[model samples]
Target: MKTIKSILGILVAALFVNTAIAGTPSAKKATTLAVDTKESKIHWLAKKVTGQHEGTIAISSGSLITSGAKVTGGSFVIDMKSIVCTDITDAEYNKKFIGHITTGDFFEVEKFPTTTFKITKVAGSNITGDLTLHGVTKSITFPAKITVAGGKTTATASIPVDRTEFNVRYGSKKFFESIGDKAIDDVFTLDVTLVAGK
Candidate 1:
C-alpha cells in the first residue's frame, strides 16, 4: 500500500508539471516584422501651365507587423528628398524643382525630415491610424485588403490626403491658374502595401 501511494503521488506531480508548462506563454507565437522596399512605390503628380509632372517618391523604411495568425500593426517612413519630376528632362531643371519642393515652399524637409503613419486600429482588413506629414498630424482611415496563407501575410491599401492641410502650398498658382482658381486641389493620394512571413 505504501509503494502504491508513492507511485500515485509521482504521477500527480508529473501531471502538475505538464499543466504548468502548457499554461505558460511561449515565444512561438510572437509577432514578426517585414518590409519590402523594391515592391513599394510612392508617386505624386502636380500640374503646371503647360502640363503635369509625375514621378515616384522614395520610401526609406516600410515595415509590417504580424503575429502567428494575423497582422497587428506597422509603420512606414518616406524620404522627402527622393521626390522626382520626370517631366523635367534636364538634370538642372529636375534639381531646381525638387529643391524647391524640399524647402519652405512645399514639404520643408529640414523641419520635418520624415513622414510617418502608425496603425491604431484594424478591423476585417480595414486600418485606421494617425498620419503625420509636413509637421501636421491627422487621423486617417483606409481600406487594406489583408491575406494570410502558409505562414505569410500581405496588406494593401490606398489613402488620399490634402496637401494644403500640411502647409504645402507650392504650384497653386501655376496649376490652378488654368482654371481661374486660387486654390488647387489639395488631395494627394498614396498606395501602400506590406508583406510579411512567419
Candidate 2:
C-alpha cells in the first residue's frame, strides 16, 4: 500500500510538470508590434549629374507582425513634408531644395503629403511589398535584415524606386531628351531602419 501511494505521488508531480511546460508561451507565437516611429527613419537619395541630394524622412506610423525572428508582414507611413536635405549645407539652399522637391517637380507633397509601404509576403530576409507614392502603387521586392532580441525587434532594408513609375517626370531622363547632365536619375534609393518593441 505504501509503495503504491509513493508511485502515485511521483506520477502526479510528473503530470504537473508536463502541464506547466505545455502552458508556457511559444517562442514562435504570432506577434504584432507597433513600429517605433521615434526610433525609425528612412534615408532618401536622388542622383543628378551635378551630384546627389540625400535627406532623412520621418515615419508617421506603422507596425510589424512577426513570428519568432521572421517578419511576417509590416507597413510604414512616410512623412513627405518631413523631407530634409543634408547635402546642401546652406540653410537657404537646403530650404529651397526642400521646397522644390516637395512641389510638382518632384514628390508633390502638397497633393500627396505621405507615402506608404505595405508588406505582402516575406521569405527569410527578402520582402515583397506594395509601395505607394504620389498616389501610385507598385509592387517592389527588397532584401531586409530582421532580428529579435530581448523582446525588441529591428529591421533594416534598402529599396530603390523609379520615379517615372509614380508619374514623377520632373528631370527624369526617361521622359525628356537633351536634358543631359541636368537630368535626374529615375531611380532613387530609400534606406530604412525600423524598430519595434513588444
Candidate that would win on lDDT: 2
- Model 1 lDDT on a 0 to 1 scale: 0.74
Model 2: weakest 10-residue lDDT segment is 172-181
C-alpha TM-scores of all predictions? 0.70, 0.85
| Top-scoring candidate (TM-score) | 2
Candidate 2: what lDDT?
0.91
Candidate 1 has which clashing residue pairs, if any? none
The CA lDDT at 122 in model 2 is 93
For residue 55, model 1's alpha carbon misses the true position, in angstroms, by: 1.6
lDDT of 1 by residue, 1-198 (tens): 999999999999999999999999976554656666665667676554455667777778767777656667888888776777777899998899788778887888888888988888877767888889998988888888877766567777777877866777665653456565334456767766655553
Task: Give the least accurate 10-residue stretch of model 1, judged by summed lDDT.
Answer: 174-183
Q: List runs of model 2 lying over 4 Å from the truth.
A: 1-27
* Residue pairs that clash (backbone atoms under 3 angstroms), model 2: none
Candidate 1 stretches greater than 4 Å from native: 1-30, 47-51, 148-152, 171-183
